[model samples]
Target chain A: MSFRGAVVTFPGSNCDRDMAVALEAVSGVPAIRVWHGDAELPADLDFIALPGGFSYGDYLRSGAMAARSPVMQSVIEAARRGVPVLGVCNGFQVLTEAGLLPGALMRNASQHFICRNVKLKVENSQSLFTAGYSAGQILSIPVAHHDGNYFADDATLDRLEGEGRVAFRYAETVNGSARDIAGVLNEAGNVLGMMPHPERAIEDALGSSDGRALFESAIRSLVEA
Target chain B: MKVRIHVSLKPGVLDPQGRAIHHALEGLGFEGVNDVRAGREIELDVDDSVSDEALDAMCKQLLANMVIENYRIERVAA
Candidate 1:
């Protein structure tokens, strides 16, 4: 059976196409496009991606409106059923707002939008999303956002770290995130949310193939399971 | 009925936008500005029959994110 994936698109989503293309290239299957208003996903989807961009123009808060959209309700149910969900950049903010992940993505402490490639250390190699990366391996991924700084209480941070739920950590401080967290996995290890754009780094044309392994690993896990 | 909701970040939560505005005021030579914190105000028009419990539910569910912010609701006679 071929790998099946879907990419959700919101009004201001710019990276949905890139995420679909990346999934298609890596999984050898066409990705279904789902709009934010749709109440359900395509049947039997192996992966669902919430790509980057200013959904709802970042109004009220980053991802606040999008998180409450019609489609996210279905996505939340699907994620609970064990389907893999990957949220990138603004999508990360959505997941947090939707309560799929703990904490909030607040504005950078510097109060300036940051756009650059930053180094990330793979912190958990056991998650479905990070199995292809070795623990402690540093890779460069592009991060561009005004509200990417991660914040949670100390106890929540400690719990996430102790439970091996932190998937990636910034090798250097880029956005003033608490504890330099770049990415995290849900308790079930199926849902992953990260600020960096791995989809943007998946090919040599982008000057990096560091992100290809992430897609490849998801596809591999789907096929093997 | 008219209701006013004031949503403010929790005291311990960092307010980056508010901090930036404070710095801008300082740059403009505004002296002795003790502190600055930013919050939001929302007004709602509702039926006179709407109950207090229902309005509180609205604030708890959507008008405020309790994790980092608190909200005050005021009801005004229409």
Candidate 2:
């Protein structure tokens, strides 16, 4: 069966096309574009992606308004049913605001909008998203965001680390994310959220092929499973 | 009935925007400004019969992200 994926687009989403292109290029399966107002997703979706962009113009709080959008209810349901979901950058913020993941993305400690290629170490390579990478292997992915600093309480942070739910860690102090967490996996390992733009790094022409493995890993897992 | 909700980042939570404002004040030679933190105020106009439960639900569900912020509701005389 071909890997089927859907990419959600909100009004202010700028990276939806990039995510679709990346997914199509890697999986050889064109991703269905769904709007935020759509009540339901296309059936039989193997994966769902929430691409990075300033959803709802980052009103109220980043991702705060988008999290309560109509389509997120369906996305939440699909996630609970074990469909793999990847949320990147603003998408990561949406996930945290939606309570699909722990912690909140706060303003950077440096009070500056950071945009650059940052080194990240794959911490848990067993998840569907990171399975293509070797454990502790470092990859350069581009991160661009103002509110990328991840914050959570001590106990929650400890639990996430103890359960091996941390999927990626910043090799350097890119942001003041607690414990240098760059990406995380849900308890079931089916939902992954990160602040970097993996979709932007998928092509060699984009100056990096590091993110190709992530898409390949998802497609490979879907086919194998 | 009128309700005013004050939502604020909890103490110790890093507030970069607030800190930036503080720095600007210090740069202007303002003294005795011990601290500064930013917050939001939400005013709600609801039916008099709306129960406290509904207001609490509104805050918990949307107005305040309980993860890093705290919210306090005040009843304002109309």
Which regions of candidate 1 deviate over 4 angstroms?
none
True contacts recovered per prediction: 0.47, 0.93
TM-scores for candidates 1 onward, in order? 0.97, 0.98
How good is the docking of model 1, as DockQ? 0.67
Measured against the true two-chain complex, the DockQ scores of the candidates, in the order shown, are 0.67, 0.89
User: What fraction of the real A-B contacts shows up in model 1?
Assistant: 0.47
Ten contiguous residues with the weakest lDDT in model 1 chain A: A58-67
Per-prediction RMSD in angstroms? 1.2, 1.0
Of candidate 2 chain B, the 10-residue stretch with the lowest lDDT total is B10-19
Q: What number of clashing residue pairs does each candidate have, in the order they appear?
A: 0, 0
As a whole number from 0 to 100, the lDDT of residue A208 in candidate 1 is 80
lDDT of 2: 0.93
Task: Please state the Cα-based DockQ of model 2 relative to the true two-chain complex.
Answer: 0.89
Name the 10 consecutive residues with the lowest summed lDDT in model 1 chain B. Answer: B59-68
